[model samples]
Target: MAFSVDSTLKELLADERAREVLRKHLGDRSNDPRINMVLYLSLRTIASFPEAGISQEKLKAIDEDLRKL
Candidate 1:
């Protein structure tokens, strides 16, 4: 799970479009705790959104993945 998370985040950062999308939110925070907090806050935001943009099952999977880590 750690590897998957690491690789996925790497992929996101490696892609120009995704990196551009995330650069403002990511800034210079490259540490684990900061990254984890970002993930938590992002999920919290998505979970509370009025419009159903993200699926509940996907959110559950993210929770499960974080628990595994």
Candidate 2:
């Protein structure tokens, strides 16, 4: 779960606009260890629920893919 969350966070962080926003909010310290930790933690805090309000079939498909991993 942590790896999945961290990977997702890494993807989000790779986006230029998202990185800029973090840089702005963290005041040029987004790369700092404490700030990175806080951001990663908050990413999980704000993440959508597992099912993400999707249909059962879609959820099942996602589950299947996750199981493959």
Candidate 3:
């Protein structure tokens, strides 16, 4: 399935290509144990959290990559 920032973490991560995009930007944090707790959250929602460290520019980049998939 096609992915976007609005897609839930579980939805995006289900696609290997989308997962790679996340891993590329988020690095090891993409695989953190705590990630399980937010599987239902959209990347957009997570990005809204200051602690998530995903800037608007980064979110756009991730969205672009997901669109390419």
Best by lDDT: 3
Superposition error at 38 for model 1 (Å): 8.7
Candidate 2, residue 52: CA error in Å?
25
Candidate 2 worst ten-residue window by lDDT: 1-10
Is 1 or 2 the stronger prediction by lDDT?
1
Backbone clashes for every candidate come to 0, 0, 0
Task: Point out where model 1 deviates above 4 Å.
Answer: 1-42, 50-52
Residue by residue across 1-69, what tens digits does model 2's lDDT show? 322223444554666654554343334554456545444443434335452233445434433433333
Computed on alpha carbons, the lDDT of every model, listed in order, comes to 0.45, 0.43, 0.89
- Candidate 2 at residue 8, lDDT? 48
Candidate 3 lDDT tens digits, 32-68? 7788988999999999999899999999999999888
Superior candidate under lDDT, 2 versus 3: 3
Mind giving the per-residue lDDT tens digits that candidate 1 earns over 1-69?
232223345544455554543443334445545455344344435345555244666545544544443
Judged by whole-model lDDT over C-alpha atoms, candidate 3 comes out at 0.89
Cα error, residue 34 of model 3, in Å, equals 2.1
Clashing pairs in 1: none
Per-model TM-score, in order, reads 0.33, 0.33, 0.89
